[model samples]
Target: METKNITGLTEFILTGLTHQPEWQVPLFLLFWMIYLITIVGNFGLIALICNDPHLHIPMYLFLGNLAFVDTWLSSTVTPKMLLNFFAMSKECKIQFFSFAICVTTECFLLATMAFDRYVAICKPLLYPVIMTNRLCIWLLVLSFLGGLFHAIIHNAFLLRLTFCNSIIVHHFYCDIIPLFKISCTDPTINFLMVFIFAGSIQTFTISIVLVSYTLVLFTILKKKSLQGIRKAFSTCGAHLLSVSLYYGPLLFMYVLPGSAQENDQNMMDSLFYTVIIPFLSPIIYSLRNKKVIDSLTKMLKRNV
Candidate 1:
């Protein structure tokens, strides 16, 4: 028994979104359709950003990053998740790390985008100088680096602990909190690490976004340019929607540990952020931004 415990867990059985077999086909088809839309929308966003000369601004650049991140984020988890709908219990430890990296990167990207909008709206005259090519490049690099550091810290802590049995993971995708709950070790330190990282990241990013938008709002209210205010709302409004969708479920799941939360409810909340948000972001952005709409219209005409 001692030797059996010493071997540690190499693999895990993911119970997936549901334990009932009857729901398999319905969920698979549902996720498959959403995945398809996510792919098309994000790719269309990236392509529009690249092809349109008008979109060669800091705003679009960040949108391109968001689209790219969405593309990879959905791809990283959706394919495997779809497979699991039909495939039997399989090892997913490594994929869990990949998901973590993408989520961290995404958080930073959204915050950076808010900063871009703030500069554009609040400092219209100095926007060009403030968000120059060099600064944009640096900001993008920082966003990726922030994610890398986040993923490393999480893996570093988790790596130190050992698992002796292949346990069932409750959530559909790999999330830090749920994973921590099942760790064979004490996980006390890991739980603390989750709060330190998740709290700091979520709080810092949300603060930046809220502060930027608040400034923009205050500045716009004073301005007499009705057109200017309209444009600001069009762009910033979409961003706020995306931000809310991404963070709302996230806060519910991870801002604080709640033992009272049902595991199924937790998984549903995670699903909204992970799977649903990616599908909706592009639609919300394209609908709100006239430039994106014009670009789509032009492309459609050209193809026709």
Candidate 2:
């Protein structure tokens, strides 16, 4: 077995979204606009929840945290990608540690949001007591701590590996999958760690959300009044939509192996989670949420 301390590759060439020169400008503009919308929408959501007294419930509390996470989650990858697209040089240097931190933070933050939902829907009466301000702060703190811990472990392991081969990455950003592919050393530990950490987080969070929604559906069905059921479903529809989009691409990318599609297809699927999902989340959640809509309307009226 050959052991090397560090690889010769100091920088990496990212393949980005496309190879065609003609499409670069158009794609750059599109992603730039999407990124802008993502920032403004998520920022607006956080601000609204913080400023509005009526929106201080457990549900909007989670939404506020989600907005905060989305801000960084999108920022972690998209800005670099957009810059690379527009810039004369497409190659960039990404610190393995920073990439790991952002990704790990996103994963845990998402799981925490799911837990918030579980508490709110599964136990409505006790929701306030269970997800109190103190508890919510603790949850957020723990999620960040957990993310930092996981990122440190992953990055430590990655930094130990040598990458003497080609420094070009097939994806837009410093994703774990692409990182693993370029590794010149044994990646068993890295693979196992990713499988264990990522799999456990996704599975556990999705299971909780699934179970909570199941109970919610049962409760709604048991209600005799059609109007009551309709209203209840309406309340949950936004969450359900957001959860599905967030989890669907994740499950596809992380849970399953890469054999399902070629590299191009895989990149497209990855885009769903990275770009599309982030953009869709605010739109779906805000549009489906009556409270947010009303809050926005009031804000707009005040401005007008």
Candidate 3:
């Protein structure tokens, strides 16, 4: 990972969400609570899926992995942000690597989940044969490996740039854009890599999601039985909500152009995806999913 002039800057200081002294403690408390809820919610869902025999299908399998990723993703950023509220924090390359991997993997996983829904709804008979155990495992592995590959490519490119300028990062966490802005060496290649790789990943995965859901929607509308149509909507609703919540901020932050005044908006956008989405994911799943709620209730009854 070593490159020219990289040794001198061993660490970078993060300027957290706000510089106001009054807001520090409140921000810490708020995010601390949010972090706790995110961990419990995601992990609780994982445990529920594992313990419940009914949730052993391919959909929940993908969901279990999604929950795991959400936990890791939330941990990657929120803890560091929470810590920054109390004292100065040092940013490292690992933070960037972890965040990139989680975010990239999530993009693929969401697309995979969309495909899973397509199979289940669009082709009910073949759903069983189509979404086999081996295929599900393969999909999971592909999502993870795809993320790893993307992160490795970006990290390799990032290593080429030298940060000889100010070590103070404006954002709460170690993100690629802020790092690129801070580098003394030319980061044009790095920016291109982000646009190309990140853009391609988003475009490809989002295409899959859109196509899959479009098919599912058409299938649902074609169902003559009102009950069947309702069931199909119920099945796909949670996923659609999750996708919207996950992608909306991403599109705003990465795809759209920003101005100097939008720095605060950028922070708010970052906070939404990194903190809010993870916290809300399991809630969306649990509330919208009857099986998950039933499983939780059953577990509580068993213990009580």
On the 0 to 100 scale, the lDDT of residue 141 in model 2 is: 80
| lDDT of candidate 1 over 132-177, digit per residue (tens) | 9999999899988888788888777877666556466776766667
Of 1 and 2, the candidate ranking higher by TM-score: 1
- Cα RMSD of all models vs. native, in order, equals 1.7, 2.9, 2.9
lDDT of each: 0.83, 0.73, 0.88
Q: Report the C-alpha lDDT of model 3 over 150-248, residue by residue, as the tens digit.
A: 999988887687876478888998887788777988887887778788888888999999999999889888889999988888888999999988888
> Which segments of candidate 1 are over 4 A away from where they belong?
1-3, 6-10
Estimated TM-score for each candidate: 0.95, 0.89, 0.95
In model 2, the runs with Cα more than 4 Å from the true position are: 1-10, 86-122, 258-260
Where in model 3 is the C-alpha error above 4 Å? 1-10, 256-261
Top model by lDDT, which number?
3
lDDT of 1 at 294: 97
How far residue 210's Cα lies from its native spot in candidate 1, in Å, is 0.8
